[model samples]
Target chain A: MSAPEELTVDVNGFQTRVWRKGSGPVLGFIAGYGGLPRWVPFLDHLAERRTVIVPSLPGFPGGERGHTVLDSHLDWIVAVRTLMEKSGLVGADLAGSSVGASMAAEMAAVWPADVRRLALIAPLGLYDETDPPADPWAQRADDVPGLMCADPEVWKALKAPPEGANSIEWPIEQVRANEAAARIFWPMGNTQLAKRLPRIAAPTLLLWGEHDRVMPRSYAARIGALLGGRHETRVIGGAGHLAELDRPREAADAILSWTS
Target chain B: MKLMWFHLMPYTELPDDFRQRHPSVWVDIHSELFDPKRAHLMYNDFMDELEYAADCGFDAICVNEHHSNGYGLMPSPNLIASSLARRTTNTALCVMGNSLALYNPPTRVAEEFAMIDVISGGRLIAGFPVGTPMDTCYAYGQNPSMLRQRYLEAHDLVMRAWQEKETFAFNGRFNQQRYVNIWPRPIQQPHPPVWVPGGGSVETWRWCAEMEYVYCYLSYYGYKAGRATMDGFWNEMARLGKDRNPYRAGFLQFVGVGESRQHALDLYSEAAEYFYGRCLHVDPKWATPPGYTSEGSQRAGIESQVKQAADSIVRGKSTGERMAATARDMKGIVDNGYVIIGSPDEVAEQLREVAVTLNVGHLMLLLQFGNMNKEVCRFNTKLFADKVKPLLSGLFSEWEDRWWPKPMEDNLRAEIPAFLPKLAAE
Candidate 1:
């Protein structure tokens, strides 16, 4: 697998960066907090059959400047719509992780026509009063990777410093991304997406990690019931909140098989 | 130079294991810890101390707003200021001040401040603070990103409402009022001398310098911790081509005065320990929500010791290490200048140095802090007012303090009658 080409797409006059790869149908992938890392082998694996489109969420690493104007989750949804429209992703497959998963769910709900199908991995929009999702923002930086993944190796790999010699850039990017995320999901991540979930008409897939520390298994039931239209559920046994990173091959295979 | 007495009115009776047991003293700290009966006595005693400060020839008495906190009991400084306005004669009522953004219609600030000013016979120094993250973002659930914008808009609206003679409309980003007229405008011609209390944000320094308002650094960490911030403020002022008038800045210092240096140390140690150790054991996360500090300020790396302490906590350092880093111990707190405790002459000398070093004309002294009893607070107030105040009063005599309250007259400094001298001679 070859490295993906990084490109910038203008959405509503804001410059957003997207990593483009592969040759077939468009699969728009939204990123979680801290934006997407420079290296993700999973994107290369998925790119063999389908063209994977990974856009940095407005306030994340590569797109920090562009995301400043987006303050609310609604603004984020608008930006995602713009991303789809500008990227020529009409009726394309959509997928996201954690905060990104919440965004994907929102886009599918609000503009069902724009997304042909939706895959949400450990989404964060709906809240269960009895067992709320672990707050990523409140967790210590050292404790973050462990919360994101059950596998210690995966956690260590994810936490490895940015490859660039500029050591400060990585943490700075994290701060920018965290600040951006806080704008939308600070005190709590609930965007009242439960009320709007019934509006989604597209086929949906809800994926959960059994050992997910951030978003527990209890969330699958809540999200599954709230989502509208034909849907399927999958629980990856050994993964954590970020199941894709922990079980990349399984996550990608599930996504590909579902899309096919 | 003007001397003001400030009180946090701390609820000083937290358990010894509060640091171990409670998550924080502010924001998420449990409500059951606050006892109403204790609060009642605290308020009465606190008010009596403020009244005493007024009687003892202080220029002003200061109160500020904090929410969901064991430390700093005043959620509404304006209410306390209102109560103080009637009881004290001639002392400027410095409600430093109502948090503008928290109010639905910020004109409530204008109206209430005006009311206090009128009641105090034109002695109102209006203080506008953007407020702490614990108070504004976490406790109030305000969007950290929009907080500053909202604060700026509210400040503008309040200023216009106070100044504009005609009943006009205010179309603000955060607030909209068709008929923007506040009843009972302040006694001072233009709005009261507006002082902005800040915690070393570069933007705040620029804003204060730009607006020509007094940049009051409410440093709970004391003069040593505040040197960099105050210097930065001066440098910003210089950069903006503003005058280096000492009165344009104010610094908050916690001072304990006694008959001797050792005596002062003995008297204030327990109270200082309670304050530095117990009252400030806040959860690191509660202290800083992202976007609360501006990117510019964050990059500038301007912060207080409290924020640094919170950072250490978040990094998950051992308790002893974190406490050491926070200067929670009596020795560290005193050595770091968090509290200045000494004999009258010693405290006065140190304060003079602080005034000269910070180049501040207004010295707002926290004579009462932590769990210090009412009698001790009263003693500290009297000793400082009688001995320490006279030493520093003439330091900045040349510069005009435009921010000081415009009292109708100096009733407190009234002349002793001619007959009294004749009676004394007879």
Candidate 2:
């Protein structure tokens, strides 16, 4: 098992970090809040067959500068589409989790021809007043990891600072990553994303964690019903909102088998 | 030296076990805990206290905004300032002030502030605060990432609205108005002096220095804890080649004056304990939103106290343990410089040193804090005015108070008829 390679590609002067691994069909992955500090078991499993291209969601971690420029959801959609083009992930199978998933869905809907097969894992951007998504933004820094994964300690270990990292810059960058995502999906995750969901023409897979607390299993049907193309739902057992982080192999298989 | 009376107007009747039972005192505090019936009396009492402070010879009376907060109830300080404008003739009405970003179109702030200035005969010290993360981000549902951008843009619009005489088409990223004409313009030329209340953000010091506004530090912890932030402001002033006009700065302190040192402790211990222990019982989540503090200030360790408070919560430091550490007893409270309590002579001497050392012309004192009854608040107000104020008056007499409000002269002021009978048409 080779370690994933890190590369920084400039997009319209904004430096975006993209992680590259494995080989086959290209699969672009975007992780959730505080973005991915590093690749998880999820990306590694997906990379077993596919050439995984995981771009840090703009303004998140490696894409820190995007926070200043991105504004509305339209701004986010354009930024992600351009980032995909610049990272050489254009026309690749797309998969996004949580906030990244929200951005992925937006890209597919706005620029339908750019994405091949789309996989969304408990994505946000839809708000139902009656049974609204549990707020992911208003969380304490320490409790955030626990909310994202079934086994909090597993994700916590992955997010813990690596050796030789500057202590002050480390926590600041971590918080700033959230700040970046927050600019796009702050206050409420909804940006009338429901209105545009019907425009997504790509074959879609709606992957959900059975025990997902953030978006919940109930939201799958609401999300699926609006899709314009062929779509199906899969539930990963013993997983939270981020099924990939909790049950990586199962999640990877879920995306691979469906798209294949 | 100018002394300003500031009231935090906390809900005095939170159940004795509030910090124990409630998860927080702000943002998401149980609404059922609030007693509106009690609030009716509290509001009137608070208003009376401000008016009384005005009569007591404090140079200014201040009120500020906070949303869904326990300790500070003035969600709309402009409303309070309007009432004070009519009631108090001599004192400056410092509505320190509307959260710039929260106002939609932000010209609303300009219009309302102008009205207050007109009604108050031009005695308005405008305040532009970035507001706390809890107030702006959670309670008011503002995006923390965009909050500073929105605040700066809103400020530009407000300043232009106040100064621009011609109807202008104002276009900005956060706000847009086709006709930016504010009626009932301020009597003061250019505008009322601006005061920026800070929580030690490094950027605020630079902004205040550049704008020539008073940088007021509103701290729950007293002067000892504030020296670093004040020094940071002075350093920025020097770098910008601005004069050390002590009037360019303001500092808030929690003070208690009694017949003796022991009597002062006995007089204020409960209120001080309530303020420090209960009013500050915020949920850690609401304290520091991501991007709420700038990277520079966060790196400079200016926002470290807020982070430390959050860290204490994460450690599951029980309320008993936390309270026992700081404001559990009066001795701990006074020692930590959270409150300055002593006889009039002692308090006067202490405050004189605070003004001189901090180089602040405006001394905003929190006389009415926590659930303190009106009687004790008035007692403190009267004692400070009679004994303490005189001692500090000579401290900054040399410096010009460039930031104080400039009211119109008596002969130049507007005069309506003393009484008007009912209209014949009515």
Candidate 3:
């Protein structure tokens, strides 16, 4: 399955950049904050098996500005629904990364019939206020291999500015976004997601990076245990929070295999 | 010229009855002690101690990070630093740091460091450590072998993030972010001074020397074990053709003071034993786990320790016995230079010798060790500052001045642009 070539949708007050490709059962992808259009490589592979829809989230470069209030969960659901309807996707397999993962969980709870299956990679929204989230940007910025992959050389090759900025600015922006998100979802953004998980009817697969400093893999088991539906959780070895970037093939394979 | 007193607030003397009832009870010493109610008390006491240190003429006070361990009670050193920021007046709040590799993105460190630096009114010595294998590899799940690489990258990213004026992209192996921009930048223009702490790693020595960073050798074992490490560093500096600048080098030692050496020993022996036996036991596995320690570090640490121990045995010496005896003899352990426990005068004299011998510009005294009582730790700290510090300050001042001469204004000039950007008419 591959992502769609073009799928425009209104977000906040502007048209957002969304793409869809392939021709099978539709699969929608919602990316994390600051995530761009290029992160849809997995969708390209998934497109080989199914139709994929990917949206450039609001406030992200090349995407529409987010709402003034910027309720990420509500905005994400609206955007995904808008993309699905625009792309003629009645029902689709949904997946998201970071903040996007929270949206997927929300959608599964609120619009259960719309999503057939769920794939969440290092999902946010379950953070407990008492137990603080590990800020991966601060902890592992200097550690290229630690942040990206187990292999130093692999990290070196993939090393480039995140998307819109250069190496230095990327971390700063990431920190700001992380803090903003953390503030928005207090106590544990994902903890509430876990509570509402029983409402989800979709069979869910949770993918985590074993080296995920952002959302430590310690929470994976708890997240899996909470879902009432058939739930599977797998750790991608040698990968950090952005596991797809670190181990793209392995991440894609996990998703593809699961969907198949 | 700045002085900072550091203490790891450990539960030194658990009551005998408590121990009898709780032997091997897995008390979750770190979490339990920090559980809100107790944590508030402990933190308040620690803040008072630090404030006392400041009142006693110290320039700064320090705290550090550890995990799931009783050795150092601080799991989040920043929390301590933050609290100190509000309470402290003239003292610099030093957090040895949040281990870089254990973090994702690594910018969270940049942000927090910046925040703390600003909050402390530029009174921040941002300490970065690659971290010990036991802490880094076991607790944080970082591969020790790749620890250095991760640390280096994290350092580079944070530095760039701090210094860069414009929004930029950071595409690195580990961190990928677009629109790199940070608010509330550090109060210091080019960020704060960076201090790297190590325990006698050759790689650390070379890197510190190369980077011209303040290399702090935490001499937990005392001066004897630290002698070779400091010598190795000076030798490396010599080979690099850099003058032996004392300001670039620092040493940390554990100190306990009393009316006499025997009194000090009596007071600290049990706590020292707990530190060495219970807290310091590296679980061999955590110390040198598979794919944890780097090949270079492995060669220097485990492999070298093994070879040296083997050599001692081959020479028909009492190798095992010597090793075991060294482990048991707390005073010999300190005198041999792992720790330094004595009266104020004795500790002062010892520190002076260490500074002169090692040509160390900075001396970081761990006033608290093992589970030493908080009151005892505070008293020792006051005694050292009041009695000991004044005696040695003048002895090293001339050396410090000679080696670290103030920078000439011309030499310190900034490369400002001649042309300024014009603003559009509002």
Which candidate number maximizes DockQ?
2
Classified by CAPRI criteria, candidate 1 counts as acceptable
Please give, for residues B218-323, the per-residue lDDT of candidate 2 as tens digits.
7676787678668777887898899988999888899999999999988999998888878888777666666776777666662354466422211212122233
Off by over 4 Å in 3: A1-260, B1-3, B12-36, B301-335, B399-426
- Give lDDT: candidate 2, residue B360: 87
lDDT of 3 by residue, B171-207 (tens): 8655677866777788776777778887555677788
TM-scores for chain B, in order? 0.91, 0.92, 0.82
Where does model 2 exceed 4 Å of error?
B302-326, B415-426
> Per-residue CA lDDT of candidate 1, range B210-298, in tens?
89899898867788867877887898899989998999999999999999988998999999989888887877756456666676655
Interface RMSD of each: 3.2, 2.3, 15.7
DockQ of each: 0.37, 0.63, 0.02
Order of models, best TM-score first: 2, 1, 3
- How well does candidate 3 match the true structure in TM-score terms? 0.55
- Model 3's A-chain: what TM-score? 0.77
RMSD (Å) of each candidate, 1 decimal: 4.8, 4.5, 15.9
Docking class of 3: incorrect
Q: Which stretches of candidate 1 lie over 4 Å from their true place?
A: A151-161, A165-169, B302-324, B409-426
Question: Ten consecutive residues with minimal summed lDDT in candidate 2 chain B?
Answer: B312-321
